[model samples]
Target: MRALVAAAIGLAAAFALILAVTAVGAPSGETSPEPLLTTVPGPKK
Candidate 1:
């Protein structure tokens, strides 16, 4: 059906857009040595 074709096209376009953005925003080879999460201080006894 026409609606099915339109939906498929829309999905394809969206997927392509996502791929383009991800490629543009791809990370460099560098990485941080420390973990991203920090331990919260616990209440003192």
Candidate 2:
């Protein structure tokens, strides 16, 4: 259990680090135009 927890944390940290690096290293002009978060309303049943 301890090992599993440690692995999960490690993976999460690595993912966060990767995202940070990508965001920081990317050129401003090349950024995506789309929003990072989006929601769509569901049709009523």
Best prediction by lDDT: 1
Expressed as tens digits, the lDDT of each residue in 1-45 for candidate 1 is 999999999999999999999889966798889788688869899
Q: List the residue pairs that clash in candidate 1.
A: none
Off by over 4 Å in 1: 26-45
Model 1: what TM-score?
Answer: 0.56
Model 2 reaches what TM-score against the true structure?
A: 0.54
**TM-score of each prediction:** 0.56, 0.54
- Model 2 CA deviation exceeding 4 Å by range: 26-45
Clashing pairs in 2: none
Error of 2 at 16 (Å): 0.2
